[model samples]
Target: MDEVQVGAGGATDFARWTGEFEAKVVARAAAGDPDWARGARLDPAVARSVQRFQVGESGDGANLIGKADRAGDPVYSAAVRLFIAEERNHARLLGLLLRAGGQPTLSGHWTDAVFVRLRRALGLRVELMVLMLAEVVALRYYRALRDGTTDALTTQVAGLILADEQRHVPFHCQRLRVAFAASSRPARLFAVAVWWVLMVGVTAVVAVDHGPALRQFGVRRADFGRGVFGLFAVIVPSAIPLRDPVRIA
Candidate 1:
């Protein structure tokens, strides 16, 4: 059987993504860890924001892996596992950074708990849709963290995560495009409409919740909201066939 017929579509080959993920792993190993010894410092508001994000990064990977296994593709399943590892590594890096800053990681965050539960109730297709929302928001969040901060260590970590996230968008897009391949025109429209709404809601929450930190780093809350929306509009259509990607003017 072909790979696309199994948990993929729109000419997306999970094998290709798998290869890319594998290469990333190799590159990451070669690059070694970020200069963690350099230490990091953040304002109180920023530290709080980073702590919440750190909690968000460390998530229920087993839930996603189970869904991927049920999707019936070993290659995709392997890739998902690798993807989970990358996320785990991110959490670890953030935790170390927090310690370096003389702060403790939060044991739990209510929003992360809710987000994890929401994704657990979804199938691989819908789960990726929800996960993509976080990914897009993260792209902007990390970018701001990278460019807005004066801390070298924070910038390094943010840049590393941002590069991985840039790859993640297209990785999911290929599969989501496949998942929506069979939907009718109206169905696709409705799904996109609902997705856009959810995206807006989540982005708004993040902007408000992290407002003080963003402001401290010189990012306006409204601008963060606009940035993710712009990024989302561009890629949203790529996940659904029969629609052109929206251009942000």
Candidate 2:
């Protein structure tokens, strides 16, 4: 349980998130990994659920990396590279977890394929906004796996991934703040409005798509959607959101 070093002289070295991500790299290396030998057990519904998530996590991230490089911010690019690595690691961990449960990683999911294509079509700022939707949903999904499941190994894996995601939300938010720093208020508000709409649609799709596994983990579909909505509400305003992210009841 050794704490991950966040670099020396902890006086907020991660003004741009590179320091924080670096600390995560060191911590993950030092921490090694969950004991895979213990194996795992999951319901068929949950196994399928994990498979879809594994595919989502397995993206190469070259697209995002290229965009980050184009932004001309070395620090942000560095942080993004590390971020991609973490995401890759998530895929790896889930793949191994699937193996432990005697399951196989999915080749691909249509939703992810379309999602990747859409992200590639957008600028960095917009792409990250889309990506943030996934991150927000993940924060809750992983929590359900960790807290709702009785399986020890599953809990361990979910806890680890969840920890990374918790950091990811704000990291993206800070970058977004900088990305939009020069935008006029009206423009920023428009983007926020559009972003809110996307978040809502994606949340509903995920809630329905993963509903079975969520119920197995004691989460209702409505609850899942609401949880994401609450998180998105806070995130929207924090990241120059459009008019406080109205929930519309």
Candidate 3:
């Protein structure tokens, strides 16, 4: 199947995952545990960051799937759909943490709005590359949180989520490699520019928001850089070979 078809199928899968995720969030919300609520309130910065995280997942995932659907590619669509599913699970995990601490979970609308505007301005491939970079960064953050926290539940949830994020790096890089390979010289150049911009932008955001949370959690901010490098080392090298023409499945 073509990239467009794959994207469309991924969008449909995203929609399905969104519904399932919503159900889980609602159930967790109703549970109303004080420790969960306290944890939710433990770090305002972290809460805001998680809210932004959800927004990116919902808005960006929807946009990617929508574009891929228009273009018609089942493989691309399926990969993105899997992305949406994983993101939804991340949101649900955050929601569960919020509920356990006894705080209200914020909606993902803010991040979604930011993503929508960015997508219109940047185009799909650039947007996706940036999103992937952010995901890779997030995977590192979560992994650190998992390792640092002694709370059994927090550790377990973060560990599971981190494992899923490990899968995301390759999937995202695969799609990006395929897209870049299929493009002309000019398109590739444009993609490179966008990749740098995204890398810088996400790095700035992480520095401001996620950085402090790590400190509060008793982890050093420098660890984030190391983690990002680790993720890049794994993903970028694997993607290099496919820069010319690659089958993404």
Candidate 4:
């Protein structure tokens, strides 16, 4: 499949991955290994949240590209295409990690429904900014796991996922820059407001729920904080300059 063109939609592949992952999770759960089961369970909620985030904004991102294509915004279109592809890959990686850990794939009904509503209510720029916030949270979570885990498989999976996520940083930042560039003054202020809300909201949710889970996995919560801060430092610098026009393709 050409990377330049959006490949056939990922729904079919995503379904297959979901089924296979659930089966693996069920098997692991039945094995009666608490550590394994618990570790695996982490994958489900995380996957559900991510699935919601992606499905919610994917169409807007696509529509943006479609508009850019019509308007001959090749650079933006190409970047958006890469963004879509990265999101698709991200969904797959989350599924894979869940399966490897032996957790069931949670029903994404709520996320899907939410995405439907989000499509109607939000613009592409707002949606994309929200996605960046999600990714920032994910990068922190994954990095924490990768750094704090002693399990070889967990570390391996986390590392692999992190690699893909790292690639997304630039794509998301570029999209944010483009969106900012195209926005009017009022829109820019609104975008900043929305971004602040998302970032704060996501951080709060992560702080509340993630601590217990990490403790269950024998990971120190402080270590998670360190990982998150480390990621924040790196991502903030990279994302700041994104307001400047740069060639991403």
Q: lDDT for each of the candidates? A: 0.83, 0.83, 0.58, 0.51
Candidate 3 displacement at residue 69 in angstroms: 1.4
How many collisions per candidate? 0, 0, 23, 2
Off by over 4 Å in 3: 1-48, 58-60, 108-112, 120-122, 184-190, 240-249
Residue-wise lDDT of candidate 1 within 1-249, one digit each (tens)? 111111223764588888888899999999999777777887788889899989998985999999889888798888888888888888888898888788899999988988988999988898999999899988899989998898888888888888887878888887787677767888888989989999999998999999998997799999999888888877776787555532221
Clashes of 4: 2
Model 1 TM-score is 0.92
Off by over 4 Å in 4: 1-72, 109-120, 182-190, 216-249
Rate residue 94 of model 2 by lDDT: 96
Candidate 2 off by > 4 Å: 1-16, 241-249
lDDT by residue for model 4 over 173-244, one digit each (tens)? 544554455445565556555556656655665665566556544556566555555555454434433243
Tens digit per residue, CA lDDT, model 3, 138-219 = 7777766677655555666676666666656655555556555555656665655555566656665676666666776676
Cα misplacement distance, residue 175 of candidate 2 (Å): 1.0
Angstrom error of the Cα, residue 90, model 2: value is 0.4
Using all chains and alpha carbons, the TM-scores for the candidates as numbered come to 0.92, 0.90, 0.69, 0.59
